[model samples]
Target: MGIVLNQSLKNTIITYIGFGIGGISTIFLFPYILGKTFYGLSNYILSCANVIMPLFAIGMQNTLVKFYSQCKTDEEESRFLSFTVLFPLLLSVPLILIGLLFFDDIAYFLTKKNAIVKDFIWLIPFIGLCMAYFEIFYAWARVHMHSVFGNFIKEVGLRFVSLLGLLAIYFKWITIVEFIYFTAVIYFLAFLVTMLYAFRIKKPVFQFVIPSNVKEILIYTFYIILSGSVANLLLDGDKIMLNQYMAIGNIAFYSVATYIALVISVPSRAMHQIVYPITAKLMHNNQHDELNDLYKKTSINLQIVGGFVMLCIFVNIEQLYEMIPKEYSGGILVVFMIGISKYFDLILGNNNAIIFNTKYYRAVLFLGVLLVLLTVGLNMIFIPIYGILGSAFATLLSITLYSLAKLMFVVKRLHLYPFTAQTLYSIALTIVLFLLFYFWQFPFHPIIAIGLKSILVTISYVYLNYKLVISKEINQVIDNVLKKLKIG
Candidate 1:
């Protein structure tokens, strides 16, 4: 718990800083400097890359996390690490070759609705390959329990470099077309940096020998590929569908609004970096009681933190749209729909870790594939009629349904639950705060109004959670901060 708190706090700060840079880029620079068409084109390229990333990496990222702790000796660990790095090439090479052999057909199909995507079609797999390897290396770091440096590179370094690229466009140093190419280079650089950092943590012994658990590892990796694809599809599939059904520019609007809503999930992202590997270790050790305790704590703590973020976003969503261009304002509904779904996910704590690390992962994978189909079906039905709003609706419904299924499987199969009395209290608190502050706004600039309202919300939310002691871990965190300030 101490290490989780310590690193999660650092990761949270780093993630927020990254999201801050990304917010500036997505909310301000991309919209104003590049305009919506180019903005959408860039995001669409990345989204496509994300959607296929799992296939390229072949699930080595998650496989490393799940299986690393089982290695009994340095020799075995090195062999496992070597497999994680090299096995992806087996699939990636063939996939790349296929992409080359069918490049023309693929390009034509992708560009049918939006020809702007035609020229950059090649970058999709190139970037996807880069993204896949980046996660593999990142998982390399996480398995060693050295997640902070890798997290910084993932969260802050990439966005910061991309910010400079955006500025290059602003200064007329690069054309938008060049910036698009630069984006591919940026992902490659991120992979390079993380790989180096991971090597520094534990210099790879590079044993190519297959481990005794090779069969088990292969099976897990296979299922994880589908599972990871399902997750990424749910996250970015809406944008891809938007590219197909709506104007490429609509993705730009969806990107901005979703980015704002995405801030609510930062805590989960930050915590999961460390928590995932920890959960893996716990399950590997067969520490059921301890695992269940972690489940409850993580659930309540994230609920409190994520709830605060959601409250701020919901109350200040209107002003947030005011800060962006009016053309992008239609995504206000997109924000709430996406935000609520993400909040539901956040409260589930380490539910994903529990499922992916368990033997019943195949069952959950089956559910995930079905839900991915459901998401695509919903988008097909709704996108033509409702536009980006429809895509958001599709995402909200799919993610919520998928989350509930995962939650139920974990509880029924494993006899573990993430909810407790504190869960109910936290939910009630979030609702109360939202109703109280949402209608009220400061008569000032949007920035100032958001600042004041956020302060009011934070103070009220923190004070109540502290008083009620909704989570002993959270309360202790508050105590430590107050003690450091000498104000407790």
Candidate 2:
């Protein structure tokens, strides 16, 4: 328990540092350095590969993590690693060949009236393959319990390279098309680095024996692929659909707002990645009470983290929008919708992971598909009428409904609930603070105004927790840390 909590703290520290670097790259650098269209193109290419990579990888990644942890011997773990990589490769070859064969048709479908961009299509499989293996190798690392390196490589390393790519665009050294192609290379390089690191940490071997039979694994992968696809679609589906119904230009604006609001959701995501496998291990051992404790503590901790971020953006939104083009500010509504949707999920803590790792895992796949249909259904009904806001609402509805359904399912099956009295207290405190700060009419410089607003908000949240909801363990943890540093 101590080790898990420590790992969670270390990973949270690392994820935030990585996100700080990534925030500059996406929020500031992309808009400041590169033109919106080029950023849009770069975003599109990555989104495309994300959709393709999950399916092409054929769910090998999740299978690797779930099975590798269950494997009883080093030999079995080695075999599973090799075996996971094989299916993605085999599936990818035909996918690559098909894209090459029907290049023109594919281009026509994707680009329509726009000039043929199939040259960038080749980069898809190259990237798709790299992404496939990155997940496989990352799973390899995670099961080895070296979660930090793989996470950094995926989230931060790729973002770092893409940052440089945007810088090149800013300088006009590369055309929009060339920049998109470069994204594929960046993903491949990230994967290569992980593979090299894996070799340093442990040996990789190809063996035939894995935890489950090959037939059973293949069957499992087939099901989990949609689970992966639906999950990514919940994030990436909008961009793809936006491209289909609206102009490519629209994607740039939507992406910008999405990127800003997305910054607020990172803490929740970072915590989830660290907490997921631990929840699975606990469930495997029948530790329901421990799992429930984790669910509650993590929910409160993440709300403190995520709620603060959301409030910062909610308060500073007008100023944040001032950084981008006027047209992009249209994403303001989408930002709110997406922000709430994301925070709601964040507040759910490890509910999704608990369900995904349990005997009820297949239920998640059905839920994922349902989310896609809901997103698309709402997009169809709303995009023409409201454009980005409609998509925002549609996506919000999708995420909200999905979260509610999952929350209900987990409550019924696992008998867990993240929405404690503490959650209500946090919400009430945050709202009251926001109203006071927004209406107070501070007569000061904007920088001072911002600083004062932030301080007041923080103080208000602490007061609420102190008066009504501070957990004993959190206080104990704080005292121990202070003591270790010789502080009063």
Candidate 3:
């Protein structure tokens, strides 16, 4: 718990800083500098790449996390690691070949409604390849219980790189088209840095030979591919699908709102960096009681953090949108819709890590595939009728359903649940705070208004939680902060 707490704290700071940088780039820089259409085009390309990343990596990232702990010796571990690396290339190479073979057909379909996407169609696979390897190597770092550097690379480094790219476009050092191409270059370089860093951490002695669990590993990887695809489809599929159903610019509008809402999940993302591999190790060692304790603590703590973030976003949404350009204002509803899903996702804690690391993973994979179909189908129907708002609705519905399914599966199979009376208390507290502060406004600039309102919300929210003692873990964190500040 000490290590988890310490590393999660560091990760939380790093992730928020990354999100801060990302928020500036996504919310202000890109849209203002590049214009909405080009911004949407950029988002669409990245979303497309993300949606396909699971397939290209062939689930090696997750497989490495799950299996790496089980190896009997360093030699066996190295062999397992080596296999995870080379195995994905087997799928990625063929994917590249097929993309080339039918490049024109693929581009036509993708760009039918938004032809701006046509020119950048080829960048998707290349960027996806970069994203895939970064995850794989990041997992490589995670398995070694060395996640901070990788998390920094992932959360801070990549966003910082994208920031540089946006600054380049802003300065006229690169044309918009060139920036798009250079974006792919940025990701590739980041991947190389992470991969090299991972090697420095645990220099992979490339053993091309298979580990003894080759059959089981390959089978699990196959299912993970579908599972990973399902996860990404739920996350990024809407942005890609929007390009088909609406103008490319709508994607930009949706991206801003979603990005704002996404800040709620930052704590969970930060915490998961350390918690995931720990969860994997716990399950591997059959530490059920410890695992259950972790599951509950993570849930409550994340709910507290994510709920506060959602509260801030919802309460200040009007003022926040005011800070953005007028064209992007249409996504306010999108923000609410997606924000709820992300908050729910946070409260589930490391449910995905739990499921993926367990033998019951295959069942969840089947469920995930169906949900993916449901997601795509809902998006197709809703995007046409509701546009980006419809995409938001579809995403909210699918992710809620998916999270519910995973929660139930974990409970039913493992007999572990993440809920408690405090969970209910926390939810009720969040609602009260939101209702109390949401309409309270200042007669000032949006920034000042948001700042003052956020302070009020934070004070009230933290005080109530402190009084109620909703989470011992979180309370301890607060106590530590106060101690550091020498405050009562």
Candidate 4:
């Protein structure tokens, strides 16, 4: 728990800093500098790359995390690492060949609704391949319990570089076309840096022979491929589908709102970097009691952090939208729909780590397949009628359904739950904070109003959570901070 707290807190701060830069780029700079069309085009390209990344990696990222800790000796670890490292290239080679063989057909299919996408179609696979290896090496780093550095690169370095690229466009130092191409360069550079860092963390000892548990490793990787693809599809499918159904510019508008909502999930993302490997180790050791305690603690701590962010976003959404261009403001509803759904997703703690690491993961993969179909079906039915809002609705429905299913499976199969009295208390407090400050907008500029309201809500929320002791882990951190400042 001490290590979890230290690392999670560090990761949380880093993730928020990244989100801060990303917020400027997404909410203000991109829309103002590039206009909605180019902004959408840029985001659409990245979204396509993200959707296919899991396939290119062939689930090696998760396979490494799940099995690395179970190896008995350095020799066994070397064999496992060697195979996982090369497995993705085996899958990606055929994919690359096929992509080239059917290049024109694939390009035509993608650009039918939005011809602007035609020029950048080739970059998708290139960027996806880069992202896949980045995660593969990131997992290699995580298995050694060295996640903070990799996390900084993923969370901060990428966004910071992209900010420079966006500023280049603003200063007319580069054309939007150049900016788009440069974005791929950014991903490739980040990938190379992460790979180097991975080797630095644990110099790879390549033993290409099959591991003793090759059969189990292969089976788990196969199931993980399905599960990982399903997760990415659910997360990124909306933006991709929007390009298909509406004008490309609508994706820009939707991306703004989605990014705002995604800020609420930062804690989960930060914590999961450390928690995933830890959960795998715990499960491998069959430490059920500690695992159960971790489940509850993670759920509460994430709920505390995510709930505070969600409340701030939901309460201040109207004022926040005032800063953005009017054309993009329609996503206010999109923010709420997606924001609440993400909160639900967050409170599940390390539910994903639990499911993906356990044997029952195969069953969850089945559920993931169904939810992917449901998400697509919902988008198909809703988008034509509702446009981007409909896309948000489909995401909300799919994510909620998926979160509920994962929660149930973990409880039924593993006899573990992430909820307790503190869970409900946190929910109630979140609602109260929203109702209290949401309507209390200041009679000032949007920025000033947001600043004051955020302070009030944050102070009130933190004070109450501390008094009620909603999370002992968080309370401990608070106490430590107070002691360091000599204010307790």
Comparison by lDDT, 3 against 4, better one = 4
Error of 1 at 299 (Å): 0.3
For candidate 3, write residues 237-328 as lDDT tens digits.
Answer: 99988988888899999999889988999999888888988999999889999999999999999999899889988999999888789988
Residue-level lDDT of model 2, residues 290-368, one tens digit each, is 9999988888877877887888777766666665667777888788889999888888888877876777767767877
Q: Regarding lDDT, does 1 or 3 come out ahead?
A: 1
**TM-score of model 2 (CA atoms):** 0.92
Each candidate: how many clashes? Answer: 0, 0, 0, 0
Candidates, ranked, lDDT = 1, 4, 3, 2
What clash pairs does model 3 have? Answer: none
lDDT of each: 0.93, 0.76, 0.91, 0.92
Q: lDDT of candidate 1 vs native?
A: 0.93
Worst 10 residues of 3 by lDDT: 111-120
User: Candidate 2 at 408: error in angstroms?
Assistant: 1.0
Candidate 3 off by > 4 Å: none
**lDDT of model 2 at residue 151?**
75
Per-residue lDDT tens digits for candidate 4, residues 1-488, read 87888899899999999999999988789999889999999999999999999889989999999988888888888788888888788889999999999999999888999999998999999999999999999999999988898899989999999999989988899998999999999999989999999988878887678777788988998998898889989989999999889999999999999999999999999999999999999998899999999999999999999999999999999999998999998999999999999999999999999998898899888998999999999999999999999999999999999999999999999999899999999999999889888878699999999999999998999999999999988898899889989963
